[model samples]
Target: MNPDQLIEFLGILEKLKCNTRHNWSTSGRQESVAEHSWRLAVLAMLMEEDFPELDMNKVIRMCLIHDWGEALTGDIPAFLKTEADEKTEAGAIESLLEKLPVSLASGYLAMFKELSDLTSEEAILVKALDKTETLIQHNEAGSETWLPLEYELNLTYGDEVCRHFEKTQQLRDKVREHTLKIMEEEVRGHREK
Candidate 1:
């Protein structure tokens, strides 16, 4: 909660990047670094309550700080999000946190580490929430929306994901139906004469 450290952190956070497919509100408008983090946290809260077996507070902390590294490495797109890129970002996070006070650095580093999935539970929880956000956003966006142009999944990971996570599974299926079935009607509402 140190103002000096927070200001530094926020400055770093401003440098974070996100995927190109999912734009902020307007087509040309871009989402901010803070906006990405906040939405992920919201996704965690929305989905975590259904996982009665795990610690969601941990999930919230993980999602909130997941891209603090992006403050250092910039957001890597979902398609280009490679292991080497992650390794590079990892190094950046470790170095940045080292500059902060020990107490703050310790907590920040721990949250960042959770994204690495040092353990099965932590890895699964973070992955589920991360994928869940994209899945739901995809449904909401439909074919006309921009993301479909850039991102692609093999279906294996997605099928496996929805298979294990019931809450997301419901949304995953629902998003498809809603987008496919109602998209035409929605467009018709705003169509030019």
Candidate 2:
């Protein structure tokens, strides 16, 4: 194991604790990427009870590192993502992984790739939970924190996410209901002006 290189990777990861997401907290401060990942890991552990068949280890690992690319690329909201953005993020992840010893780096890259590909069951669950957690955070962050997607939430959370991971349907439905309500309020306020 290349301890020095691994230490460098860890140092780089420390930046995530300070790298804020575009979404604001109820306190009006931007949420950090590390905060998001930590909560996602907690959710993954608790969610294991709901899916006894899948590997929780894999789920937790993916949750921890899924956004590591954002350390370099920043948290590009899914609605705003483009093929070019995706390519850039992949390149950033590839460069970061190069800092580790080959064997360990391969394992981490494989885990990250699985989430990117959304091919395995565990990867799908992590992805769904990631979205669900975002919805929950938005809900808790107050009405002022309404979703900003140009498209309807139903299109992304309902038709797309649920179609792939049916288990997330309930959460997606709830988030959709809340987001749509807030969105209407936003429109009404704008019209009154």
Candidate 3:
């Protein structure tokens, strides 16, 4: 909760990937896990006006730690999955959360639970914003590989998925446009290289 936690959180940053898939950036432009959460928490505050009914507290909390599991188990590309991988990440979150004092820990546990449970409007929007941010990143980075991006988009489904949100649905079109532009540029760069 103090400045020190922020510093310690950076150690976990090495593990989080900005894109689910590895691409052009050598370091993956991969944000450290803590930065991702911190940024998303900001996103929730600035953008929750879009979801007026959402519990802003839960949105902030969920955005803050949706990927702490990534801190322990490492991030996975959205397109690939194994039962073992999922379990390992879940266990990592459990272990990491246990390190917190009871006073500080309970709140994180509840937020993590909310993300997993996906029961609230706040959780839903936080989840949507998570995906939305990544897509925005991909477009900004102008990634070339369509398969990975396409694969990631294919992974979401039903109500729990972020793509279910209307704002993101429109944003999804933006993802496609930005991705296509990035791809075109990459192709040109590759030819010159």
Candidate 4:
């Protein structure tokens, strides 16, 4: 891609830095979509040894671009997102991809399709890590930041996806344990108040 094309493509992605997710950070601020994607990619990288047979690079790539659609639509929490919302995001992604060179656009279009299909090991790992990352972030955020349903959602959100890999399942189990602890502490604090 030429300098101008690269800059234009990046300009579209720049919105991800400004797009806020539903979850708050541990430091008590709304988390940006970029922040979540950055950490999710890191989380994928951290599992390299655990998934030696898989393409860690592809998993990392998936993690990075999984939410690029959100740059256009902002975030719609999983619970609230419907089929129409997904179609809208898909359309947004296609529009954004059109700005890129043919080679790059086609490659990304394939990657996005692979991610949606979730048939490959890399796709499955990325999807599992994506859910696990969200649960971990929710656990990190203060209980006061949580909606009542999130207490349960955090415990159960990634169970099916995480079940695809033993390591991810273990991680999900640990996060659920932490979620329960947080719930108990919040309840006790409420009673004390």
Candidate 5:
């Protein structure tokens, strides 16, 4: 293993600390991509019981690196991402992988590709958890980020989840209900005033 190459890759990952998500945290500060990934990884572990057949370790690793591309491409909001943006992110992932040694790079890149393609049950579970995590955060934080959207939630993730995981569906529905209730209260308060 090339220590220098590994260090360089680690340094690039540090960018995730500054790449902020569109949604604010419960503390009212914009959460970074690194913070988002960490929580998602934790969620993957916590939700492992729901999918006993899948590899929880692989799910956790996917959660950790799924957003590593954002370390190079920056955190683009799911709703605003375009096909072109995805292409850009794919390229960024490849570029980042090129910086690591062959042994580490091949494994990490394969994991990234597997998750990107939803090639395995573990990958699919991780993907669902990723979306669930965002929605969970929004519900917990009462983020107004989704208030102006014409849809109930961001299309990029909202539609993709729940198709594969029952627990994900439950959480998605809960978040939707929570968001609607919050909006209704705000509207009613405005009318009363």
Candidate 6:
């Protein structure tokens, strides 16, 4: 790509740094889309050893770009986002990809297709990690940040995808255990109050 195209693409990605997700940080503020993607990529990197059969690089790339569409549409909480919202985000992704050179755009389009279809092991791993990352963020955000519905969501949100792999399923079990502990603590605290 030319320098101008590179600059334009970088400029567009900057929006991800500014677009906040529904989840809050432990520091008492909303997390940005970029922050979530960065951590998700890092999480995939950290899991490289555990998933040697898959392409960790592809999984990392998926984590990084999975939400690039949110840079345009902003984040709709997973629980509240409808099928229409998903289509809109997909359109936004297409629009963004159009700005790139044919070579780059084609590669990203393939990745997006694989991700949306969840047909490959790498794609499935990324999806599972994405949901795991969100659940971990919610737990870190503390109970006060949670909506009433999240009490249940925190426990059940990623069960299906995580179940696709034994390791991911084990990870989900640990996360669910933590969610249960948090709920139990909340209940005990309320009773004390």
Q: What is the C-alpha lDDT of each candidate?
A: 0.65, 0.80, 0.65, 0.92, 0.81, 0.94
Q: How far is candidate 3 from the true structure (C-alpha RMSD, Å)?
A: 4.6
Count backbone overlaps in model 6. Answer: 0
Native-referenced Cα lDDT, model 3: 0.65
The C-alpha stretches of model 2 lying farther than 4 A from their native spots are: 147-151, 154-159, 180-193
Runs in model 1 lying further than 4 Å from the true structure: 17-28, 118-122, 145-157, 178-193
User: What would the per-residue lDDT of candidate 3 be over residues 1-39, giving only the tens digit for each residue?
Assistant: 667765665555445643233322234454455565676
What clash pairs does model 2 have? none
lDDT of 1 by residue, 39-141 (tens): 7788878776688787888878877777677676666666677889988989988988887889888977766765675464655667766766655554444
Greater-lDDT candidate between 4 and 6 = 6
lDDT of 6 at 169: 96
Q: Tell me the lDDT of model 2 at 183.
A: 69
Mind sharing the TM-score for model 2? 0.85
Cα TM-score of candidate 6: 0.98
Q: State the lDDT of candidate 4 residue by residue for 148-188, as single tens digits.
A: 88877887897998999999999999999999999899889
Task: Sort the candidates on TM-score, descending order.
Answer: 6, 4, 5, 2, 1, 3
Report the C-alpha lDDT of model 6 over 1-193, residue by residue, as the tens digit: 9999999899999999999999999999999999999999999999999998998988999999999999899999999999999999999999999999999999999999999999899999999999999999998888999999999899999899999999999999999988898889999999999
Give the clashing pairs for model 6. Answer: none
Alpha-carbon runs more than 4 Å astray in model 3 = 1-28, 144-160, 184-193
Candidate with top lDDT is 6
Residue 32's lDDT in candidate 3: 54
All candidates: TM-score: 0.73, 0.85, 0.71, 0.98, 0.90, 0.98
Model 4 segments more than 4 A misplaced: none
Model 1 earns a TM-score of 0.73
